[model samples]
Target: MGWSLSLLPPPEPELLDAVFLSAGRALHLANAFENKCQYVLRIANLASAFDEDPALTLDEAIAAAPSDKMLGQTLHLLVDRFQTPVPEEAVGLLNKARAARNFIAHEGASLGSSYIWVARADTLIRHAVALRAAVQALSLGDCIVSRWVSEIEEPNVPAPRSWDDDYPPMVDTWVFGHFNGLLEG
Candidate 1:
């Protein structure tokens, strides 16, 4: 089972916007990570199915690569349908941004305080954007495959699959797990 944010009421516009933006970025990165996982998994599946066959050239191999939209859809399905909590680092950043957003939304203060909030908000946004770009870079299927080949060594290899492959691909569980991870449980 997973936790539900829907039970809560809507937050103030300014603060809510910031929180939503942070959430969006977190999701974006999480999706990227998942896509990379799938890319490698599918490639392995292909290789495993066609063992010792070097018939396809690099160009032919790329032609057989998954489409960009397919990759995006896979990530989207993993994130939206599965709802895995994002990594701790991403959630921590989101929490910081969300707290700032909450202060912005609930607290009615002067320009000085607002300016401070805005500064923090901008920083959070910048960090989120950078994270998103790095995630997007992983969309290059080659990079994803290369990472798996390089990182997971033989004899005790971690299977190259998305987190969802470990658990049932349910969105609520992912969200709950991610939130729990953020809270350090």
Candidate 2:
């Protein structure tokens, strides 16, 4: 028989909000990388084809390149094709981003009924920073795709309107301070 883990309880609302936002941001980064990967591969392929035969068209090059792959596969192709060092850490961060996105979009209600991911706000912040690092690592000095990267601003980590005076509670001061330091650093 297969073993399984049981669910517990939902996390605090603020914690949930923070995770959802961070994961959503990471997902945005993931989408940008995915789109840029395809764009880069097509451009490179077209350039090479042009070098070989000037008759090749952009559409032909784009259709010829194997662009119908998943994001992870595209990242792998980047390494082999461009010799870029997308570290394993970066890949892990992307995967984390994807998982977080899936959880927020698909399993959000379920998350409210379980405690499997009772992570603190700082954890999400760290993940955001890691995603940025991954993007930085993948970018090239003079590549068109590098220029296609969608810039992400720092986390605002606050409600657009307002929260109650007791928001986040004074108990979370250490966490807020530590995460703020990570962002500043």
Candidate 3:
């Protein structure tokens, strides 16, 4: 909001460099928070596995992860678990945070000559803030029950309903890093 792309004068190099620096720091913090979340999930899942096989050690239980990218799948599992009280908005927010971090870190992304950096930094900073709070607030110790997972195996929907149907029809929301007709205000 502090800068506008359509303005005649492009932002100074100093400003761009500063935003870039902040972006890098935000990426690092967000990555660390994600690692912590993943570690917690690994232990939570190991607890579940141990419930079924008493002979299993934590190491043996953790070895059961079938894929290298466990955090993405584990977050989905935690969010979908009906017995846990994961916030409904948590899934989307976490997804946006991961996407923001990946785009900034992996796409050889750079601050554009205009206000694009403002938009990118805004997204990165907001998402990083959310991740930090989530990590601090997460309590995996209270959410390691396996009985609910086994008991609720069937889809008991009364009627076919899309998940998006629950959302409001429209709202003022900005998707970071995605620019169509909109520009940061």
lDDT (10s digit) by residue, model 3, range 1-185 = 55444444433444344445444544554465456556555555666777779898767887874443455665676565334675656555566545544554543134334254344545444443443333222212112222123233333633223312321111111112222222234
Candidate 1 clash figure, as a count:
8
TM-score of candidate 2 on Cα atoms, chains taken together: 0.44
For candidate 1, give the lDDT: 0.40
The TM-score leader among the candidates is 3
Give per-residue lDDT, candidate 3, residue 49: 79
Clashing pairs in 1: 82-170, 82-171, 83-171, 83-174, 83-175, 84-174, 85-174, 85-178
Q: Candidate 2's residue-wise lDDT over 1-185, tens digit each?
A: 12223363434445455545544544454455556666665555566666777787777765666546665565456545543665666555445444543343343323333343464555545544553343333232112233323211223443332222222232123223333544547
What TM-score would every model get versus the actual structure? 0.29, 0.44, 0.47
The per-prediction CA RMSD against the true structure, in angstroms, equals: 15.3, 11.9, 12.2
> Per lDDT, what order, best first?
2, 3, 1
lDDT of 2: 0.45
User: How far in Å is the alpha carbon of 37 misplaced in model 2?
Assistant: 1.7
> lDDT of each structure?
0.40, 0.45, 0.43
Clashing pairs in 2: none
Off by over 4 Å in 3: 1-11, 107-109, 112-185
Question: Which candidate comes out best when scored by lDDT?
Answer: 2
